[model samples]
Target chain A: MYDALKNITFIIFDLDGVFYRENQSLEGTKEIIDYLNEENIEYCFFTNNSNYKIHRYKEKLLTCGIEVSEKNIFTTTKLIEHYLFENNLDNIYVLGSKQLQDTLYDKYTQNSINPNIVILGMENNITLKDISNTINLIDKDTQIIAANPDKLIPVKDGFELECGVLIDIIEEYTKKMVQVIGKPSPYGFDTILSKFDKQKSETLMIGDTFETDILGAKNANIYAGWINSGNKLPYNTLDFDFMSFKSLIELKEKIKEAKR
Target chain B: MYDALKNITFIIFDLDGVFYRENQSLEGTKEIIDYLNEENIEYCFFTNNSNYKIHRYKEKLLTCGIEVSEKNIFTTTKLIEHYLFENNLDNIYVLGSKQLQDTLYDKYTQNSINPNIVILGMENNITLKDISNTINLIDKDTQIIAANPDKLIPVKDGFELECGVLIDIIEEYTKKMVQVIGKPSPYGFDTILSKFDKQKSETLMIGDTFETDILGAKNANIYAGWINSGNKLPYNTLDFDFMSFKSLIELKEKIKEAKR
Candidate 1:
C-alpha cells in the first residue's frame, strides 16, 4: 500500500462509481479504507450529485462501512452554494427539486422579471413549463448555471438524464451556453484545493468515469486513477496520462509496485 | 406577377413567418394568394407546427384572410403519420399532447417495456417522468423519431422548447441519434414531390428561416426564397444559393423578375 501511495499525500475520490454503486459498496473499498486509515493520508470524497447535503453523504458513507468526516466530503451542491453566496447572486430560478432548491433557499427567487441566474439541477418533477419559463428568462445578462456536466446517470434498468443534459436542452433552445460548476470545470477542484491547502502534485483523483473524473483531474492538473469496471467508456481519455484498473485493489497494487 | 411566376407552376409557402407572425397576416400575403389564384398556380402551405390538423389550419388561414383548401396544406404531423403508416410502425410511445397522441392512438402504446418506436412531438405539459420513461425505452433497436428539427418555437413573448429540443435531450441521454422527419431532412420534401408529382425546377420553397426553409429546399433540390425579416441568422447559408428578402413582397418581385 505504501509502495503504491508513497508519492501521494492527498487523494480526491468520486463517490458514485468509485466508492459505491447504487448504494452498495464495491469490494476493494474496505481494504482501501483500512489502508488509508493506516497510512494517515488526507483524502476527500468529491461528488457531483447535488441531490443531498454533505451531512447526508457522511451518514450514507457511514452506512456503507466507510467512516468519513462531513468536512472530508465536497459536493457540487455545496460548491454551487459557495459560489452563489460569494458572487452575491441572490436572485435565482432553480429548475430542480425542493431539496436541491433548499440548498440555495436564501438566494433563490421566484422573480422571473429580473433573475440573477438560472440554476439547472436534477428534478424528477421538472416540466415543460419549467423549461419554457427558464427559456423566457434567459437573455444576454442572465447567467445559466448547471450543477454538473454529466450527461446521464445509470439507473436500475437504464440511464437517466442529468443536469448537463438539461443544460444542453436549454442551451439548444436559447443558444446561450451554461456555466457548469462541477467536475471538469476546474471550479470544484480549485475550491477543494484552496479549502484543503493541497498541492496539485501531491494530490490524486480516483473515479470510474473518464469524462468527469479523469478529465476533471487533468483540468485540475492532478494525477488520476480511472476505475474502469467494464462500464461503457463515453469519452476519449487517450490524450491524458491516467492509470486504468478494473478494481481499486489492482490500482493499489500497481501504485505499490511503482513506489517500490 | 405572371412574368415572375411564369416558370413556377407550383409554390410551397411556409406558414409561420412567411405568411403570418403571432396569428397576424404579413404584408403581401393577400396579394400572393390573389396572384397565385389569378395565374391558376398550384400552391400549398407547408408548416412544421403539428399542434393543429390540416382542417384547423385551413380555418386559421381563412381567419387570417387567406382562403385555401385543406388539401393545400402540409404539416410535420401529417408527414409523421404518413411515414409511420407506410413503414408499418404500429407500436409507439408518444411524449406529446393528447391531441397529437390521438393522431396515432390506434398504435400508441403505454407499455413501458419493449416499445417499437418512441415518437417525440410538441407537448406543453411534458414532464421529466415522461423524459425518464422515454430514456429507459431507448435502445439500439428502438427508433426515436422527432416531428421536426426545430430547437425553439416562437411564442407570444419569447421562445419555447420544440420537439427537436426534446429529441436532443433524449439523444444526449440515450447516446442515440434521433431520426428527424421534418424540414431539412428531405423526407417530407421527397414525400410531397412524389405524392403531388411536382417538378422541383418548377416549384419554389419560400420561408423566413434558413435552417428549415433554405436547408430543406437545398436538400429537396428546389429554389428557396428566404423572407429574412430582421431575425438573427441561426445557420450558415454560404454553401447554398437562396434569395434573401426582408419581406415576401421583395421575394415576389424577385421571383417575377426571374420568370420575366
Candidate 2:
C-alpha cells in the first residue's frame, strides 16, 4: 500500500464521504491536507453532487479546517458548464436544484419551449407533474445530460433518490441516451487531468464509494484507493486490486510511511 | 367484426380515453352507454387510475350524460380493497395521493415503521423525500404492491408518470418484485369477472390504450376492442386479431348490426 502511494503525485479526493460526511469532517481530513501540501503533492476535491454551487463546497472544506483555491474544486455543475462552453451549446432547460438552475441560467438562455439541452440533477421537491413538463419540453433534436448516474445517496436516516432516477425515467420514456457528467464517466476525470496537466499513472483517486469513486478511477485509468468509512462494499471486490484504508487516518499514516 | 360482438354479455369500459379526455366527453360516449342499456348487456366502467374515488368517477361519467350506480364502477382503489380483503392483509404504508392514503388508512392501520405491505399509487405532488421515506419503511419481509403498471398516462399536454415508475424505482433498489393489481396483470380483470360472475368468452373489454386496455383483455382471455380515440397503436399489432373502431359510434353500430 505504501509503495502504491510513492508514485501518486496528484490526488483527487471525494468530498462527501472521504473527507467529511454531511457537514462533519472525518478523522485526519486536515492532517491529510497538510501532509499533501508539505510533500508538494497536487491535490483537488471532486464530488458528483451538483445540487450546490462551487462556493458551497469551498465553504464546506473551510469547515473541515482545510482551505483550497476555488479552481481546485470540481463539481458536476462545473464540468457541465465546461462541456456546454466547449460544445458552444445554449438554450438550456434544467430540472435540478435552484443553485444549479440559477448558475446555469446566469450563463445561458433558459428555454422551456424547445431547449438545445436538458440538464437533470438531484432536487428534494421534484414532483411527477414537473417530470411530465420536462419531458414535454424535449423534442427530437433536444439533448439530455445528467449530473451523475447515482441512483441513491446515503442520508442520515436512509438513502435518498438521486439524479440517476430522473435519468432512468426520462431515458426510458424518450428512448434517448443521457450523457452523464460526473464520476465513472471519464469526462470529469479527463477534465481534471487536462486542467492540472497530470498523467493517469501518477494520479490517485480516493473515495468511499466503489461504484463512483474507485470504479471511476479504473475507468479513467488512474490509481485508486477506497476509504472504508464503515460503508460496506456492495459486492465482493476481489477481482480488482486497490488500496483500502479503514479511515483517513490510516491513509495519512500510509503516506507518511511511504515517504520514509 | 359484428359476429364477435354477438355473444358478448358483459362489457368493461376504460374511462379516460373512451368516455372523456380530461373533462370533455368524447364523441358517442352517451350513445354507446344508452345502446348497451337498450341491449340489456351488463357493463361497468374500469379505470387504472387510483388517484380518485369511485364517486368521482361516477360523477365524471354522469357529466358525459350517462348515469350508473356506484356498484358498476371499478377503480384500482376498489380492486386494491378487494385484494387486501381476499388476502387478509393489513398494516399498510401507502405512497400515493391523499385520497388513496385516506381511503386505505380508514380501513387498515398505517404503519410507517415496519409495514406488512407497501402500497404504491400515482399522485401529482409526490416528492423524492416521500419516496425515500417509503423505501426506508420496507424490510425484508415487507410485501410490495402497486395499483397499476402503467408507465405513462396521456394527459392534455403530454404523458404523466404513473404508478409503474414508482415500482421501477422501488423494485430496482430493494431487488423485490411488486405485485401489480391493475391492467395487464389480470388481477383487476379477475376481480371484475368474479364480481359479475361472467365467463371470459362472454366478456368484452373496450378501451383506447393498447398496452393496458387491449393487452389486458388478451391477458384476461376476453374479447378486446380498441376504440381508436385518436390514440395510435404504439407498435405493429397485426399478429393478434382484435376488433377496432374509429369511434364509439362505430362500436354501437356494430353491436346493432350484429343483433339485427
Candidate 3:
C-alpha cells in the first residue's frame, strides 16, 4: 500500500516513543536504520523534548546502536533559540530545565517582574511560584512561547503533564495564547525542510504518535506513515489521512517491494 | 437626581478608594455616616481587601474617625469563609495573606498537591510557585474558589495587581472558572441581602468604581449610586446604568431634598 515510499526522498523521524522510549530503544528501530541505508534514503531525528541538547541526543542514539550525526538532529530547544534570535528577544523568563535554561542563559532574565518573553517548556518539578511569576509577567505584557504542545508524556511510573497542558492552563488564566515551536506546529518541519532543501511532496514524517508526528507532517503538507508497531490504532488516527503499518519491519518490506 | 436614595432603606458603602484611599478618609464619608444616622437608614462598610479581618477593618475605620460597629463591616475574606463553610470544603489550598490564611487556617490545607478546592485571594507577595501549585492541583480536578475579581487595587504607592489578575492567570492555566465571592460576583450581595433581609429595590450600593461596586449592584438587581466625588467618571461608567453624584456629601444633599 505504501508504493509512495519509493518516491520519498527524505524522512523525518520522531525521537521519543518512536526510536526509543526512555532508557531503551524500541524493537524495530535498527531494522529501519538498515532498510533506510540499503535504500539510500536520508533521514533525520526530530524531538519536542527541550530538556536535552543535540550532543546528548546523539550520545543516547549511539548507545541505542543507531549512529547519526549531530547536525542531523533537531530539538525544540534549538528551535526556540532560533525563534528568540529571529524575533530579536533578549530578555526571557523560562519555565524549563537546567539544560534549556543554560542553553539560553545569556537571554534569561532572573527576574520575571518585567521581561520581553516567558518561555514555557517541560518542568517536572514545576512550582506554583513559577506559574504566578509567569502570569504576572504576561499581565505586564510579556509574551509566552512554548517549546511544544504535547499534553501528557509517558514517564517511568506513569504519564506526566507536558508543555501543552501548562500552556493550556496559562492561556486559560492569562487569556493569552502562547506561541508554539515544535512538532504539530509545523515550525520544526519547516526548519528541517529548509535545512535539508527538501520539498514537502518528496519528504515523509514517520513516528508512533499521530498527534505530533503525523499531524505535524500533515500540517507541513508532507506525507506521513504511522508506525503502529503491531499496536491498536489510536483514536486520532481516524481524523487524519496517513499510511499505517504494523511495524517498521513491515514498512521496510513494503518499501523493498515498491522498489521492484 | 438621586430621589432613589430617599427610598433606599439599606446602603452598602465601599471602603477603600470610595470612603478612603489608603491612609486617609475621603471628604464625603463622614457626611454619609451622618445622613444615614439622621435618616435611620442601615449602612455597612464593604471592602474586597482580605489583608485584614473584621476587627482590623473596624479599628481602621475608628482611626479614620468614622466609627462603626463590627456588625456593620463586611469583607471579601468573610464572604470566602462563608462560601467555604456553606460548600463544606475543608481541604483547601489557599493563595492568600498570612492573616487571611490564619483567618481560615482550620480549613486551609498546608499543601496543594492534593486538595478538594483551591482558594485564590489577596497575596501582596504572591510567587510563581503558588500559581504552579494551583495549576497542578486544578489538573487533578480540584475546584477553584476566589475571594474577589478585582484586577487592580489602589495602594499607598499606586495601583497594584490584585487577586482577580491572579485568578485570571490561574483560570487561563487551568481552564477552570473561579467561583467569585466578592463585589460584582452577586454572592456577596446575596449574602448581604439575606443577612439584612432587604429587598434589592430598597437597598443601594454606593462606591467609586463601576467595575466592582456598581456592577455588583447591577448583577444583584439592586440600586447603585456611583460617588464620582467631583472626579472624572471612569471608563466602565458608559457600559453600566447607575446614578452618579460628585460626592457622598452631594448624594446626601439630594437625599434630603428628595425627602422635602
Candidate 4:
C-alpha cells in the first residue's frame, strides 16, 4: 500500500460518503483501510456529523467491513468535549443525543445556578421544549458552543437529523451565535494537523462534501479530493482547488500509481 | 394609557416581549388589546422571530389573551410570501412554520406541477432529513428564500430560536444562501410598507426588537416606535426616530388624541 501518499503523515477521511456511501462501502474502501492498517499509517475519520457519539462510528465501520478501533475515531463530539474540559467548563446543556450527554456526563452536567458553557450536538428528540431551555440559558449569558455547524447528516436509512438543526433552533431563540468545533472548522482540522507528523502539502483530505471536505482541506492548504459518490456538485463560485474522484478506490489506485 | 401617547393614525406593536411574549401574556397586555378593540384604529404586530408561521403566532396569541386577528399581523412570513407569489413562485419548501407553508400553499397548490420557490423560516422542527430534501431540491434549481435573518428570539419563557439558525443549517446543506425577506431587510420592510398605505412617512412601525424593527425601519425610511414594555426602561439607541410607549392602551389613547 505504498501509495503516492507514502510521504504523507496523515490522511483525513470524511465519514458519510468518503469512507462509506450510506450503507455500502464506497468503492475500494476496504482495500484502502486494509492498506492503511497494514502499513500502520494513522488516519482520522473527520466528520461534521455530531449526531452519534464517538464509539458508535467505529462499530458501524466494522459492520461495513472496514475495521477500526474507537481510539482511531475522531468526531466533533470528542473535540468540543476536549475544548470544554480543558477550559474548565463544568455546566453544559447539550442539544444532541443521549450518547453525547453520556460522553460529557458528570463533568459537563447542566448547571442550575451558574452555567458555564453550552455544547451543540445532534438531538433525535429535539422539541420546542429543548429550544425553550436553550433560548433561556443563552439569554442568561450562558456561553453557547456547537460541536459542528453541519446542518445535514447522511444516514443508513437516508439522511437523518444532525446537530446543526438544533443549533439553528437555539440560535434563533436567543438571537445569539454559537462557536463551531468540528471538521470543516479549523478546530478539528488543526487537531488532526497537530497530531499528524507530515506537513500539509504532502497529505490528502478525502471528503464527499465539497463545503467541508474539499473546501476545508484547502483552507488548511492541503491537497483535497472531492469524491462525488453522491453524484452532486457545487454550483457556487468557490475559490479553492479540488480533485474530483468518482470513488475513494479510484483515488487510492491513483495514489498507488503515483508512489510507484 | 393616555399619559404619553394620544396622537397617531397607525398602531404598530412589537411581536414578542411587548405583545404577549409567547404562550404567556405579559403585563398590561389585555388592557392594551381591549383598548385597541374599543377604538377603531389600525394596528399591526411586528416581530423578528421568524420561528412559526405568522398564523401560528395568530393562534398562539389567541390562546394568550390577546385578540389579534390575522390581518393585524405583519411578519417576515407574509412579506416573503408576497415576494415569492409576486415573482410567480408557488412551489416552495418552507423551513418555517405551518403558517408559512399555508401562506404559499395556495400559490403552489394552484400550480400543482413543479414547486418553484423555497421559503425558509425559523424552524425548530428542522431535521437533517429536511435539510437533505431542501438541498436536493435546490440542486434541482429551486429558488431559495427566507423570511428574515434575525438570529435570536427573546421569548417570555426566556429567549427562543430565531431564523439565522435555519439559514446556517440550510447553507451548509445547499451551499447556497437564501433571499432574505424580513426586517433589517430593506426589501422586507418595503414589502410591508407596500402592503399598507404608508408612504414611509405619515406611518409608524412598532416593535420591541430594535435590531430588526428599529434598524429595518430606518432602512425602509419609515417611522418606528421602540416598545419599552414597562420594562427595557431607559430605552436607548434607536435605529430610527421612534416614540417609546409602555402599553397599547397608551397607544390607542394617543392615537385618539392625535386624531382629535
* TM-score for each model: 0.86, 0.93, 0.80, 0.63
Cα interface RMSD of each candidate: 1.5, 0.8, 6.4, 3.8
The alpha-carbon deviation from the true structure for residue B34 of candidate 2, after best TM-score superposition, in angstroms, is 3.4
**Residue by residue across B1-260, what tens digits does model 4's lDDT show?**
23223444455666676767535676666776676667654567766554455677787677658767787786776676578668866556665576666766655653223457677776667554455555555655767777777665555555555666667666766677677777777886666556767665555777776777777777777676767664443355632356666665565556666656
Candidate 2 C-alpha lDDT tens digits along B98-142: 988999999999999999999999997988888888888888999
Report how far off residue B109 is in candidate 1 (Å).
6.3
Any runs in candidate 1 off by more than 4 Å, and if so which?
A1-4, A28-31, A107-111, A170-177, A228-236, A242-260, B1-4, B28-31, B107-112, B170-177, B228-236, B239-260
lDDT tens per residue, model 1, A33-142: 77777777688999998888788888777766888888899888888888887788777878886777886775556556668788888877788878887889878899
Q: Candidate 2: global Cα-lDDT? A: 0.90
Candidate closest to the true structure, highest TM-score:
2
Local lDDT at B105 for model 4: 68
lDDT of 3 by residue, A37-126 (tens): 887888999998999889999988876778998889999998888888877887788888888888887654455567788889887666
Highest-lDDT candidate: 2
**Number of the top candidate by DockQ?**
2
Query: B128-241 in candidate 1: lDDT tens per residue?
Result: 777887888878899888888887777777778777768767886778888888898898888888777898888788888788988899989887777877566765557777
Give the poorly placed runs of model 2, Cα more than 4 Å off: A1-4, A236-238, A252-260, B236-238, B257-260
Give the TM-score (vs. native) of candidate 2. 0.93
lDDT of 4 by residue, A135-235 (tens): 56664578888877666556544455566666666665566887778766677777667766567766788887776777778677787777877647668
What DockQ do you compute for every candidate structure?
0.60, 0.83, 0.12, 0.26
For candidate 3 chain B, the 10 contiguous residues with the lowest summed lDDT are: B152-161
Better of 3 and 4 by TM-score: 3
Cα lDDT of candidate 4 equals: 0.67
CAPRI classification of candidate 4: acceptable
lDDT of 3 by residue, B1-260 (tens): 36776688898988876777667778767777877798899988888878887998888777666889888899888888888888877777788888778888765555546778777887756655455545666655678888888875544433455787668667765777888888899999999888888899899899887888888998999998888754456654656668887777787888788777
Q: Decide which is better by TM-score, 2 or 4.
A: 2
Clash numbers, per candidate: 4, 0, 24, 20
* Deviation (Å) of A68 in candidate 3: 2.7
